[model samples]
Target chain A: MSPQQPDANPSEKLSRYEPEVREAYARYRETGDVDAVQIVIIAMVREHLPKPSDAPITDEQKLVEDLGYDSLAVAEVVFAIEDTFGLRIETSEIMQISTVGSLKEFIAKKLGPKNE
Target chain B: MSEARVMPTDKKGRRRVVISGAGFITPIGNDWAGVASSLREGRHGFERVEFFGNPNVPVKVAGTVKDFVVESMNWRDWKWPARYEIARETLRGLAPHGVYAICAIDQAAEHAGLARGALANDDATGLYCASAGSAMMLHGHLGQMDRTRGERGNPMGVVSSISGTLNFNLAAHYKITGSVCGFVSACASGSHALGYACDDIRLGRLNRAVVVAGEELNAETLLPFAAMRALSPQSDPNVASRPFDTARDGFVGAGGAVALILEDAETAAARGARALAEIAGWGQAADGHSVAMSHPEGRGLANAMKRALSDAGADAGEIDYINAHGTSTPVGDRAEALAIKTVFDTNKKQPRISSTKALTGHPLSLAGAMETAFCVLAMNEGFIPGNPHLVNTDPVCEGLDLPRETLNERPRLVLNNSSGFGGSNVCHVLRAVG
Candidate 1:
């Protein structure tokens, strides 16, 4: 969190979403592997996920058909992910994207060569 | 010989427009009944501003709304200051004036018994309002942009900063589809908006419109007026705004929004809605004679009043009350006095005159709407708002009946005056209706 955040308490964590997003970045960042970050990726997708779906949030869960995120909410989630991980995600990547595991692998590949 | 000239657009079904509801937030009162009762008793709304405490800032007093705090936007919890972060995170921009405008419109909608099911299917329910400027939000946004050299700051905040966003926000919120406009005519902005809304309804274009005169007091807006020597010198809020009095200095830069519902009389009748007052006539003119000052002879001011009276087809003598644009400045009060003299002096019964600014302070663009609302209150409640601070009228203000005490006269015709810088003058003629 920025030190100068006017409203938020300094000691408080940004959100449960923050640690989930950061852990995913570190997983692929350290191991040079995408499979290890699958749990982290699932946690990130569940931030606004409705209850009743707690049994499973598989890669095939479907972004809109199952999660109910409209285009705008999807853009916001993508932006938050990009800002948290400090990577520029392109609209082409966003539009062609489907399935959660594919997104996690795509981010890992984009972050490759820059890390170890 | 000059032949009688008829204006076009007369063929359109000229619907009669009337005020069905009014809502206001002011120093004296937040609702019409409370504000109107305060006005009848000749109470002042001026108070020391609480928000801005910069000592070097001029203009010590303001008619600030008592308890309207800018809340933080947390959609779920709705808690303030904390939700502020959530608000900034969610929307590209936000506006305090927009909030005030919505609050006033809510009051008006609820008052007219049209909030819930009334406007559900109405497509023609549009609105027009005046926004002086959302200075605080704009200035803060600009400062951040400058600090980051335009690279990081939220450029979206610019929408909240300008004077036009209120129109869009209001229309979208109310689901209005007819037309949404924000008029900027300096201090006369409110009157111009009201007058134009009345025109649209009268011209058979819109069925109902909410006209909001919204302004929020902030350092960005106040410093400019203070620099112009427009604010009164009297530090004490109690006696600072002495409109039309001999000892008057200048206006107090205050803040508030007043919203009124203008509806076609036939539609209002069909709906069985109570009509507060009939918007009989509207007149607007620019005093090209001066830019920052009104014509000393009040030619433009007189012209607007004469045109309004003519438009209403009411003789000068028929005017029972005059809500003067007496802004407490020496020049403004004198110019308005001369204009009133020229317009109504010849009548065997000159209208009773008083400046409600004595109570609410000069609410900038909000002045016209609030004063016009006060006129409706005066007509309905059968009480003339008195000049509470009128200890001595200026010599130039003589020959007019400045009501020192609140009179019990039910006015048939009320002319409300509002003038602005760059030579703008607007008069709205409100007539009593059962």
Candidate 2:
């Protein structure tokens, strides 16, 4: 059987870190870095990840399955990201977030002019 | 270094409890053996507080643990990545007291060689601890909220500062399923935990348990004591912790943690675990007197000692050494001294008395457990503790032979005493099974 995907896009109306998302987008456009957001997540995963992968960063890698980050670690990473960007991650957004690529995509949408 | 050796013959039904392993982090030393050596060498570790200073308070020096990093602790069962950065960030919110709690337990578990083979979760494995939760965890979280002007703050960090954090964190770490308790009986908290760990084994309730007690010294915690004039008036670190001396003012605040792994004699022997000193007996009592003052006649502490001796099936004259709950407060020291003299007559060669606090300053809840570990080391290594700042003896301490100088000898039986705030008193009679 095929695995269950998030039936509906949780980010459709998800608005938590409006201010931080806007600020991060402005910073990303200039520097291509999310002003410590990605760094914080990297730190959260690198702490206990058995072997920090050498592969190029991508969006499809599963947090738990590929990176070996536990649920607790994922929560911590999310918390740090929200704190760094000054936003709150809704449960719906959290349910849909399982990969680094997906989190960045979600952040991009959250930071769009219309979303802001 | 290893703990003192002992052998309790297999009993028919009743069980014997032994201190199998210990881990200590104190101002004087990082481990139990090192701390014992420092005591024997008449070295003190107190130094002026570097982080916080108040010109108004006479309490200047504090016994702080030097150069400690949680990354250095040995982790078992839990896998770690080579380029670990995530775990460090995730755990950055935990308090120093909580971190020390984990280190002490991990060290004890490793010292007992529990890492060699993993054991299944069962009711026999238990944890009992005494800790004053992390002030940093609390104040740090609150301060962040105030600084950021944020309405919501880290609630989990606040919970981690609660006293039960150690019980939850360590029990889950070791997979202990039995009775797990984190007690707070002030200074006697460690003794309370140790005594009851002994009880649980003796009653056949648990096969083995670890007892730990720890306190975190911080400027905020020290300020109240200074305000109450409960800390040493002297600004110098050398004479700050003069336990039973006439010049003694009050205790220099020091903080650290100690862990002692206890096992049933049969369980230890079957597991091929060597025994440290045997916990012969433990007696506890409460002084119905004032909360701030121990009994003037030292009746409460003396009663605890008498009961412990009786429980050990030994007499007063049999005890060769006594570890007094000497905090260096004028009244508290006098009360403990009076209690020792009352329990063991000074007419004979009074049991050589010493306060390990003189070296480590009082680690509050960690005092009793750390002292027990020190007693075991002193026995196996034959090192008597001496007061480096013993200039003049108080009137109450005159009759008692407070080993003013370290003796290069071993003691057979020892009594460890601890009295806390709220009128709590406890005594443990330890038999050096050398």
Candidate 3:
């Protein structure tokens, strides 16, 4: 049997339609390109980063510590994501998002297949 | 002349209030020296700048503030060796005017020899400010809600864009323990703030007060005046604003911030602070007239000036100079002319009348504080700022002694008159101090 990937196992996460689903998810499903979703998400993240830097923002950078995003900046970034991607990310969902990579993966999974 | 003017202070003894420190960010200049030079040279601060890249806006000329720059939420200029990089978190709640307000207050406090952070937790020091809000932030906030169909909005939108934005930000940043208030009466808001601050000090409610007035100069805040047909369409920077002039069409828009420290005279003396000018007295009256138009006779303005003189225990003849609230608007200037005629003209003593608005365009909410601060500067610097552009005087202003050139003479007693939309009028009497 093939080795199981970390993201391959999904036990507790946001359902495809928990509150209201995003229209962008439907477009993502049509192409199933996570890279495209990550690119757009990263751009939005950069725009809302509280402390701008010349260094490149990596997917592994922690949102709160590395980006210097306090609660207010986090909310701004979340609002920007919801507006840009047509997603209604819940307050409970934000606590679980620690790193930029995790956020992108979680958002990408919402647009991925139902059965692995 | 109808009823004898009586001093109201005899009943409850009043404390004296004086202006100890002043700071400003004006289009004419940042400091007294710079502004005095501009006044003496008859220089105007008007500039033709594109607003929002829109070519259809009728008004183009404005008294744009100079040497002020903010990058990455950092205040970089306006004074040498004074740079402040506001954290983005705090900056989130501040509008453009709030930025200028903070800087002006800092400069004022520093000029007064008050140590940095000295006002924190100081209950005896209060704060009063006048601002209409940040139009650019308001526009952005409202546009976001509209675009999202109310799905998303800026968290700080309400506080950052509302009328009391300055009071909120300033009080918090300074950690003010005393009364924190905002005055809103259109262009007269600043005057109202100063008047009330003086009252607070005189009543012993507070030992000192920091009064600030600021405005945002952007297409959002300024272009709206164009819709009312209240803005001058003159494109030339040289003659765009001609207060009390027959050729004047409308007022030109300007923006900046001014702040002054109004403290108890005895308290200022004890603290070894030099007094710039004493806030002799102040008054206010309503026109009971149109919302957008002043009384044709300037009845409320005349009453305000009279009350201010009475409050100061002085007569019209006692005033050495009069800083007219002449915005150069055809109707407004004429009304003011009539008001001056009713007051000083009736007394047969025309103090060298002038509207520095001829040099610095109408700064709206910042007008009262700016003009009053100019009065303080004139008192200290020994010069009367000229109207400069009053060449072809309006017929109604013929009786008024509008000086066309700056006079190198100190004014002992100065009266400042300010009127706003909704017929709000406020006047203050300032006296030079040793």
Candidate 4:
């Protein structure tokens, strides 16, 4: 089969990532959650990461401990995330977030489907 | 019984400190006379200009110092060795002395007739400064570096860009051996620097200190603000900044520097130096909100104002004038107005408020000190400067008593407010002293 060819349609293709992506997509489709926190984090990391031609960033990569980001740079990232999501991230929460995966988890907690 | 008057000093018996002299480089005009006249005349300093590739950016007006020539002065007179060549060249004309922060400190020290090492040898003497960022030299160096070169792209970038090092450089230049440091709190930086210096004196940490606020305007930084649509684009190139006006669009970006010679009041009296004004109180607060936006309710700003009054032990009704941080932004102006209402609501006696940004433009880090000069001027002249080009008033700013035009009157107490990008707010209360 060609590289472009896939057995699933676009919707099914998107669902392969994780249930969170599907839920995010559903929220986006319903209320246009363009300002979602996860989306903002993705966008910020995408811009800062080394290009595909350079070293690729893994989801598990530590943003500061491994990537060598100083406090100011991290503050800039946090600012971008807050601006994107229109939500206030407490300073305490910011102190706890050190890795990409941790950030993703934080966003998922805030944005995941409501139990009610 | 005319007994010998005892000299007041710190624990080590150094002289006390107060503000003996002040200098301002602002948008309206450079010297005190010119700035005072312009403010009194209600002159608007904004004008249209082509900032970027965008032509229809709608607004174009800024308080620009068109005639400033920084290239004409001698470099050696500016105390420190020139670390950045471009900065050296920029400082040449404007100052007869050198352009470094130390040069400013030395000049203020010299004007006050103090000895060279007064700030250095006196443990009580310290250096406090507010700067937006280190000069653009670091930025230029970083830009030239090859990212491909990794960490070795530019060695000086790290050293020069550290926010605290600028004061170290100044201390080294002026031979100031006392405690030296710089504060970075965005736009309110200069005020915080002054306030911190005052706190040290009030606490008896230093017998005297030097406070300097320096702002350098470079295309590198202005371009970013222009891109962000944070500045006014008045096309006329003159009269572009209009603060507190209904048609006010945004702030006009400009830069300059100011320095204050703060000494203990008793020491100043002994030296027979004229005490310009009393540094009474300071208040600071964080909005804890968006980095680029202020809280809509202006809660943090109100708290800062209330705290400032409490710090001064003065009632809100006692404030005669206010030097507002009115950048003319839509949200910032409204938020500040709400804050003013909350603070001065009891007697319905609104103090006269005016935006000096109309004259000086927004000097970023240097704004606090530059506005401090205006407060002193207002207190001395007993007149409140007007918000230039303020024809129409916003409905939200309706109840607030803003100075529509220049008003001549003696203001006993003045409150100056400076708010920055990261939700940092600072308020200083200045009082006229005999």
Candidate 5:
């Protein structure tokens, strides 16, 4: 699968180290699979959340209201993504993202279509 | 220097300002008793620290704070007021200096017996602080932005890491409704805060004010001085910060916070608050000279001292002791000694003098606040601090009476002088009050 390919349900619920997310991260680590980028992004977001919660984070969850990501925290997560994927995210690009799903989609666009 | 003294106007109906409470977190100690003991015994607070994990760093000695928690809001073990259980949300907006500020203010408020939240929404109360923010935090935040090309950073970075961080976080924490401001004249910032706070009270602009000055200890803050060759290279902590000795090289950098509560004398009396000292008068002047060096003859400092004396309607002879801004630098100490002689000797008065910086090191912008607070302690404790480690005084200090030991004498009038980078000078005159 290409890095730009969205999950079956882009708004699907996610949590830290959940089975499928962890599985994707392991696959990404082992094979450099671009398809696991979304899961990797979700895991990074969960790690940056100020407060831990049992409620699974969804793509629809607002970064500010639901995940408690202030502007700085948002910057932190974006920087983390850039570090992880060797990508450069712009400030304007960050502003276009509001919810978890939007962030994943934004990263998907930044990563571009898979290498043919 | 002017030979004619400017007499103060009639003060029959003028409001009077008094120092009701003061607190500090210095290298010596947190409380007056402990600090006094250290000063009297000539005990210095310098310690060698690993500088920025760099083996080639030239300076290693610093006067670090003792008996205080680092990177934590909990000061319960430090015996601070119970009101210091600061919420984590508020802590998020504060830098290390801001934290020290609030902690010092907590002690001040409790010492004044101010009811919890008494200043909430009170427009008559003011908050004034002298701070240059947290260099460590600023460096980290800016580094993140630099590495990411400004795409990512901490939301609280600007407010928590700049010079005005104190005014922002402190005013919000205390709910100050009056003038919330930060003074920025470098080392003279602390004295400027106190002097202006006194003005507000004396002029009836404010009935009460909390004044603070704080600095942070970190490689980002201290190492820059090493680059400037402004830090002492002496490895022995005891002799590193010799303020007036001819052999003195440079100041030993230090960090901490000091706070004082100024109140209308009548209001303090009504509230049954004890006055530590009466802030008689204050004066400020500029050198218009170098950006980082004092005037060769300390002319600006002399003018400041003269103005302060004139503002108080007192003669130079009336001053029993002087707390000199002697930071042990080669040029700076000589300049200050010359300034002292120009003011007092011209008036033919030989007041006892000493620089407590020999004990606490130079706390940068907060030096004035910390040293003035020391003056208050000396006045109340009936002793004058010695110029410790002054083995060989410079020739410019020829006529000055720099005591070699703490004097067991009570001073009726005390003067504290501070000079900052850019040659900004501020002086305060305090009178012992019952």
Candidate 6:
């Protein structure tokens, strides 16, 4: 059996969502770009990405439980995320997408090619 | 936290708003006795200062409240923390029952022997306030915001800096949950606040209202006036504000707060409250010209005076005194004189005019209410207060009957004029109650 490669540090392993998220947030702030929806979803996940000092994070890492965000901070982040992606995350959906990976999947389903 | 108690009623059925008590925090003195003594002695409180830039600016001398101690009061003791400090200081020695606005609301309510929360649900009670720098405290909070922490600037900046919020906060604190608003017409702010409160009561919006006016000391506010060369630079600091003299350079910066409890004559009588003076009438107008300069003809100001007299149901000849808005600026003094000439020329007899700003540096928003307090005192005491530092009157002001010295004579009616930037003008007519 091939030797198992050590799992990359969570902070070192750039999520597929990182660059797209930063680019999307930058465009939204500068030009109110409507084309940055996919990028904003990626940014939202990156915002929850753990630092290298912290334990490795996963799609299953709960936003409040793992990231230690208060309701107010979470609400603020959600507000920013909504403004960026032009989508309304219902209160129920907010509860379900507590983990970074789950949120990404949820955003993908909401922003499917047909829904643009 | 419970509901405010209602005042007991007597069978007499008449209710009146009276000057049951009075207070003053002025440049000449902090208490009523001291202020009165200073006035009687012909004391002018103007002095020079270097606090603002352009020390060489010719405007020297102002009427500054002497020996003010900003540390005497705690900052957070009142609902509107900053203004409460100023208001409490203004009410330092006054009796508790007199109705007042701004910092004195609670004190005034308590002094009036009304139970706490007595005014809370009273729709017939309201509040009116006026000032320019009431919201100045927010600047400090904004400065404290940390950008590194991703902090947005304080969201409370605009609300705290708004000029009208001073009285609104006072009303809210006292549970005087009646009709509330503030007027902002530059220097005319105080007079307008009182005038508007009187209107609200007369129009039946409320049975009584508290009219309060105050100006706070702040660097941002002082810088603007200094930039305009409107402040005094007297070296002595105590002698910088001189109002009507030929050598007068400009006004000194001073802050003051005053409150008036206004009630209908019938109501005051029914309540057996001591009637201080009847608020006869008020007039307001605009210069319709430069925001910072008055019309040389004084036509708009003259009209306001005339309207106030008419509203008071008194002819111009019947007015015995005129409290002028003489800021000691060359143009302002002259424009006011011209306006006086226009108004009095049409009357059978011209009233004697004097400026309280001679004794109290221009308090801006508080000037009107402070002057109003002076008028109330003048009518009640039967005295025409002197123009303290005036030596040689301007040639343009020659024909006017200016008070050379304080005179102990009762006047039937007094007309107080306050004009401000943006052409805003207000005139109040007060008559002594029997």
Name the candidate that leads on TM-score.
2
Residues A59-86, candidate 1, lDDT per residue (tens digit)?
Answer: 7767777776556545655654554444
By lDDT: ranked, best first: 5, 3, 1, 2, 4, 6
DockQ computed for model 2 against the true two-chain complex using alpha carbons: 0.12
Q: Flag the better candidate by lDDT, 1 or 2.
A: 1
lDDT, candidate 6, at B433? 66
- Full-model lDDT, candidate 2: 0.73
| Candidate 6: Cα lDDT at B404 | 74
Off by over 4 Å in 3: A1-71, A81-86, A91-116, B1-12, B69-82, B345-347
TM-score of chain B of 5: 0.94
Structure candidate 3, residue pairs in collision: none
CA deviation > 4 Å runs, candidate 4: A1-116, B1-17, B44-61, B65-107, B110-118, B147-162, B237-239
User: Residue by residue across B371-405, what tens digits does model 1's lDDT show?
Assistant: 89889988989988888888888988777898888
User: What is the per-residue lDDT of model 2 for residues A40-111, given as tens digits with 9 covering 90 to 100?
Assistant: 344434543544455554567787888876655566566555544455667588889888778767765554
TM-score of chain A of each: 0.64, 0.54, 0.66, 0.57, 0.71, 0.54
In model 1, where do residues sit more than 4 Å from their true spots? Answer: A1-116, B1-13, B50-52, B71-93, B153-155
lDDT by residue for model 4 (B146-208), tens: 532332223234434456545745665556665888888888888899988888887777767
lDDT of 3 by residue, B1-434 (tens): 11212232332367878888888888898766777778777798889977667777788799988766531222212232255445455566788888778778887887777888877897999999999988877888898689667766776788788999999988988899989999889999999999999999898899999999999788888988999999999889889899988899899999889999998877777777778888898998999999989999999999999999989888898899999999999899999999988888554777889999999999999999999999998898899988888779888877678889999989999999999999999999998886
Across B1-434, the per-residue lDDT of candidate 5 in tens digits comes to 11222112225455778787887888888766778888878888888887757767888789998755553222112233354666544566777777678878888888787888976798999998999777877887898779656655656778788999999988988999978899989899999999999888878898999999999877888888888889898888889999889999999989889999898877777777788888888898989999999999999999999999988878899999999999999989999998888888644768999999999999998899999889998888889999888898888789889998999998889999999999999999998875
Docking class of 4: incorrect
Instruction: Extract clashing residue pairs from model 5.
Output: A72-B155
Q: Is the docking of candidate 2 incorrect, acceptable, medium or high quality?
A: incorrect
Clashes of each: 0, 8, 0, 47, 1, 33
Q: What is the lDDT of candidate 6?
A: 0.64
Native-contact recovery for every candidate?
Answer: 0.00, 0.00, 0.47, 0.00, 0.20, 0.00
Candidate 5 wrongly placed segments (more than 4 Å):
A1-116, B1-12, B68-83, B346-349
Off by over 4 Å in 6: A1-116, B1-21, B46-103, B106-117, B134-136, B145-150, B154-159, B236-239, B346-348
